[model samples]
Target: MALDETTRQVNKRAVAALEAAVWGLREADVSVIKAVQPLEDLSNVTNAHDPALEELNALTVRIRAAREEVRRRWIAESEGER
Candidate 1:
């Protein structure tokens, strides 16, 4: 997707945090799982302001949702494995 540098960086960091959440789940790291919450919040802020930014914000929201879904699924799978 085409995004300005700021949007791109925000997306990158959000995805990275999401990935970290998944890894944290696997490792049972409370700190990492907690860290994802603020990252999600930052992701929300990154898209806040300006009508044109709405589209980018929406994209960021979708990406964040996807990340949450993956993290949830990872947790579920981990439970199932146990």
Candidate 2:
């Protein structure tokens, strides 16, 4: 059966959130690599705080939450249709 407009919209939002999460992870990975590259030659390394990393982490969390919300809504709607 074809999905109704609301369901289609939910699915699209879910997909977009998933894509954003993936992209965020990739960006985070790159940031981490860049941050560590300078210390690669050093024997002793200390943890350093980075604002970019923090922001990316927050963004990833939000994206996952959005995805979960979409899934929950879709499941609830499907169940209601039965």
Candidate 3:
């Protein structure tokens, strides 16, 4: 079936949004791996109040914030929202 121009535009946007979502997930995965490397280096934290642990917590917050925005934007685009 031939799609109308509007439908074709929407399909393009959706494909881009889905690709963004996939990239966002991959970025999050890499962030987790990089953040966890410090734990292995520090031997699972020298103490409960370790600096590496603190840094990891910060990175988690940052990654979560970024990923959430990507997810929201992708959902909005998929739903035909500008």
Candidate 4:
């Protein structure tokens, strides 16, 4: 998609934040992980400058969503068993 200038900027920022979060995770930077916690849907992050599509972008989003759902289900099941 042809993004407008503002969208391009936003996308750049999102991608940067996502990359920083990943690197922080690899480096075990707790602060960076906490900072990016709210931005769980990583697919919303884009990097047009990247030479190819990034699997990490989509994977993060999917993983975050699934994690949340799984957590909720686990909690509910545990509560039911109580």
Candidate 5:
């Protein structure tokens, strides 16, 4: 293969890997949110909050932010922005 073709193949693989990782992390976050939703609902019923759940919710926000960053970087890189 030509050098440019080889480079493109490598970049494709790298992008695929990055996409898989980012999507997997997002899926895990969804799973965690689903798991904790019941607990949060119970807290609402009792008018109380669980610290661990609160922290997990905060962590979810951070993870979402990270995913957004990753998405932006992915788009930039795909557009040949280095």
Candidate 6:
């Protein structure tokens, strides 16, 4: 069966968030491994540096939330069908 508009939108957002999290991790890896000067320049110097690392952390949170939302909605839908 086809998903409703709201469900479809939630699923789309979840997928997008997952993709973004993956890309963010890759970017972080490259930033650390390649020692990209420009990317490094964007980081603050005060101990808590690394903008890519920060971005990856934020993306990880977003991905978890999105996946949980998708799972919760899917479970609700499945229960409703029974």
How many clashes does the backbone of model 5 have? 0
TM-score of each: 0.36, 0.46, 0.54, 0.36, 0.72, 0.40
Task: List model 6 lDDT by residue over 1-82, tens digit each.
Answer: 3568788676666656656655665565555445545445556555355766566556556656665655555555545541
Error of 1 at 63 (Å): 1.0
| TM-score of model 2 (CA atoms) | 0.46
C-alpha RMSD in Å of predicted model 3 compared with the true structure: 4.8
Give the poorly placed runs of model 6, Cα more than 4 Å off: 1-49
Q: What is the lDDT of candidate 1?
A: 0.58
Q: Residues 1-82, candidate 2, lDDT per residue (tens digit)?
A: 3568777777677667656665665666566566545544332344354444555556657656665665665565545542
Which scores better on lDDT, 3 or 5? 5
Candidate 3: tens digits of C-alpha lDDT, residues 1-82: 4568878787787869676776877687687878777675776546654766667777777777777777777777666676
Worst 10 residues of 4 by lDDT: 47-56
- Against the reference, the lDDT scores of all candidates come to 0.58, 0.58, 0.72, 0.49, 0.79, 0.57
Q: Please provide, for model 5 over 1-82, each residue's C-alpha lDDT reduced to its tens digit, 9 standing for 90 to 100.
A: 6999998887787777768768987897898789778878888677565876887888888888888877777776676676
Q: Of the pair 1 and 6, which is ahead by lDDT? A: 1
> Per-residue lDDT for 14 in model 4?
56
Clashes of each: 0, 0, 0, 0, 0, 0
Best by lDDT: 5
Better of 3 and 4 by lDDT: 3
Question: Candidate 1, which segments miss by more than 4 Å at Cα?
Answer: 1-52
Query: Model 6 clash pairs?
Result: none
Candidates 2 and 5 compared: the better one by TM-score is 5
